[model samples]
Target: MEGKDTDQIPLLIPYKLGQIRLSHRIVLAPLTRFRSYNSIPQSHAILYYSQRTTKGGFLIAEAACISRAAQGFKNTPGIWSKEHIDAWKPIVDAVHAKGGIFFCQLWHPGRVSDQSFEPNVGQAPVSSSDKQCSPLVDGGVEFKFLTPRKLNSDEIRPIVDDYRMAARNAIEAGFDGVEIHGAHGYLIDQFLKDQVNDRTDDYGGSLENRCRFALEVVETIANEIGPDKVGIRLSPFSNYMDAGDSNPEALGIYLAKSLNKYGILYCHVVEPRMEVMEERTECVVSLGPMRRAFNGTFIAAGGYEREDGNNAITEGRADLVAYGRLFLANPDLPRRFELDAELNKHNRDTFYSPDPVVGYTDYPFLETII
Candidate 1:
């Protein structure tokens, strides 16, 4: 009897989200770049994306604040303005020209902001309560701990409407879909996590109440841009942006069941872990619970490698894999993976610098022309 061909490699297959069939499972994760031109995605952004396009792949654009108050960072993009929507059209067009699908991640920082980023002049950041988000204050010149003002019933309605408007704006900007930035302890996550939400109103005090805000945003966005074009990101136990849930498991169950009502395309779940291990195992490791909760196509992200990514699909834990830092270092990451070429290491120093030419477009790729 011939020796068993143990080397039969499992074919790395493509995944689908509703009608959108991806040629590969590699997804470009939503990464924040403070390189927006005048708080709007610029021509450089179009060039930046054009360089990173992969055949049959999808790119989740960096978080764009849904409203003025949603902006906490110095130079992040926003979808609330006409200029922002107009500016993003070319970028979306460029991505489509390369046969790639793009989705803009809509976000609002809420309490995770400073006075400089406030909407109303000199107003404090808003949240579910008066709790301070940051645990540290470097200094007045650098950074300081900020206590957020509570959002009253009157203000909550318009804030929820902002998401609906942002969704409409995303469609105007020529995006394939919109992903709600409900992760990383931002506004929606802040409302979801009990630690930050101390409200006695209908929006808080209980798990269901705490989730009310996020659910509203989801429903509103779905209604504005059709359910098939809407998706969300959720990190049940992420400590990065000070988001914490009393019971992550219960939160996942509740969120999953609630989100399913919208008929959205996918629920992107970030796998929480410590080590910088391979992507496949690390991605799915935290998803066993989410997979049980969410019945739709699931996109798993955070520190994934090719092998670990393929395992996620083969194991049925994830429908797609979102790659972050890897895409930054290798513009042709999907091609590099197909060829099994060595990847370029990313420079940590220039990760967030103002200099446009350095980390933004300096990475090289295989010489296909040669």
Candidate 2:
């Protein structure tokens, strides 16, 4: 196949977000590979990440649970212990050795967790309210979610502290920075959305009150690690894992404006495709408004092809574009995009398997395939 002219692709251009400079606008979105065994990153992770690293490329690690109670999936890594920190050090080093920038995504699953996956099996998951939801787990089994116990007013601070310490852990583990996983129906998103957060305390009732928990977590983590080194991911229109908002556009704009106060490194937003699961009058809620509201760098993710991502960046819809499946199948994704090369098809079946290699690091580079 003939290569596309490099001048036509805006994705190959370098960009800077605060102190972090990236060689290209293509970012490797955080993907849950589930290769970590016993909640610790293993040797396979180093190869899995380094293979995708391009010089000065920006890669966000898959969400690392902030605490044991925050864990929701099997084999997902954690950053809450000394061993977890020690384990991540080499993985971070490998990316750095390739001249890449890495960010650890700190996460908490909240009420979206199953009893079988909890530290205390049979323990009910905790959330802002007692609403229960049954979500599909691995192997297509529908796991019945328990009615979560409402977090006591005093209990909220400890969760914030958990995020603060996790930020510290990421820095110690040699990560360039940290991205707070406030999106995708996780703990922070659970609190931000009104459909799930039914409470009369300071953490609920008004929009400002509802945003309190998310703000606190961001503030605490930013203080722990410099605000310039911190970023956040938000899915205002997402109903996945049962997180939906009455007014996503308004919520997104409010968050964008609020986040501007801290001068964070970037704010990552999921594109409209992921929000389609929930019925909406508008097929695609534009990120343009949110982009204009925020002062810092903005990243757009979900359902973006090379041309779409380049258009989004060139049109000023986002400062960067994150790709998930494309990067997963093409270890040399940046070069492939630059050349308009054929992308390897990703096998969905092997996405979360515990195999050390196979689909994980076995994807051949362009040169190897040639």
Candidate 3:
């Protein structure tokens, strides 16, 4: 891929995301691979991330829990302690050695978690509301969410501070930046989605109120690390874990406009027609409006293939396209897209499998393909 012509593919073209110049617009989406053991990033991740690294390419690491209270799933990495921060250093250095720009995706699962994953044992996870998220069953996997205790008004500041600390930890771990996980019915989305947030506080009820918690996190993170090193992933169009909005378009537009106040490095949005269920019936199919409203680098994700991804960048639907499953199976995803080569199929069974190398680092590169 070093010397081969890019063939004028829109996704292969160079673009600048803040001061960080990317050689291409194909992003490695933040996916929960469930390989990190005991809430700390394992050594296997070094090769896993390094396999996908390319010169000047951007890769967002798997979502790392911002604090003990924020954990919602098993085996997911964390950024809350000295051990967690130290564990991520070598992995970050591996990606940097390959000249890839890595961003640690900091998240708080909030109510999306269960009792077993909690640090305080049976203590309920915190969220904007006390409503319990429905259990998730996909691809022969089942996850039952515990009823979350609603955060008291005064309790909100501490969680925000956790996010700030996580961002600082990400930078100290040698990551180029951090992407806040505000998408997919996690802690932040719990506030944004009216379907689950049944509150009448300063953080719920109105659009601004619902979004207040999110913007505060943005402001605090931006102030802690600097706006240029910050980005956020949002999913206003889809509902997972029963966190649906009454009006997604308005919610998306509101958040997009509000995010401009902080001037974050980029806004990565999950594309429509996602794993949306009852919300899918709403037929929300475009990210154009949100992309237009946000006055920064825009990254569109979810179910994009080579042609459509190229079209998105060229037609200005987004400045970049993030690939999840495709990239997970094809470590040389950028090279494959460049050559229009056959991609290896992804095995769903191993997506969250406990095996370290079976599906984690076993994906083949073009050179090794017979």
Predictions: Cα RMSD each: 4.7, 2.6, 1.9
**Reference-based lDDT, residue 183, model 3:** 93
Against the hidden reference, what TM-scores do the models get?
0.90, 0.95, 0.96
Off by over 4 Å in 2: 1-7, 137-144, 275-282
In candidate 3, stretches whose alpha carbon ends up further than 4 angstroms from where it belongs are 276-285
Ranking by lDDT: 3, 2, 1
Error of 2 at 191 (Å): 0.4
- lDDT digits (tens) for residues 79-192 of candidate 1: 998999999999999999999989999998888885454445667888888888764332113334467888997899899999999989999999999999998778988889
For model 3, what is the alpha-carbon lDDT of residue 314?
81
Tens-place lDDT per residue, model 2, 157-187, is 9999999999999999999999999897778
- Candidate 1 clashes between residue pairs 3 or more apart in a chain or in different chains: 279-304, 279-305, 280-308
- lDDT of each residue in 1-370, candidate 3, tens digit only: 5757886888999888889888999999998988888898999999999999998999999999998877788899999898998999999999999989999999998888854465668688888888988877654577888888999999999999999999999999998999999999999999998997878989989999999999999999999999999999999977787888999899999999999999999999987676432132335358899999999999998788899899988899999899988899999999899988999988887888778899889988988985
Which clashing pairs does model 2 show?
A: none
Per TM-score, the best of the predicted structures is 3
Clashes of each: 3, 0, 0
lDDT of each: 0.80, 0.86, 0.89
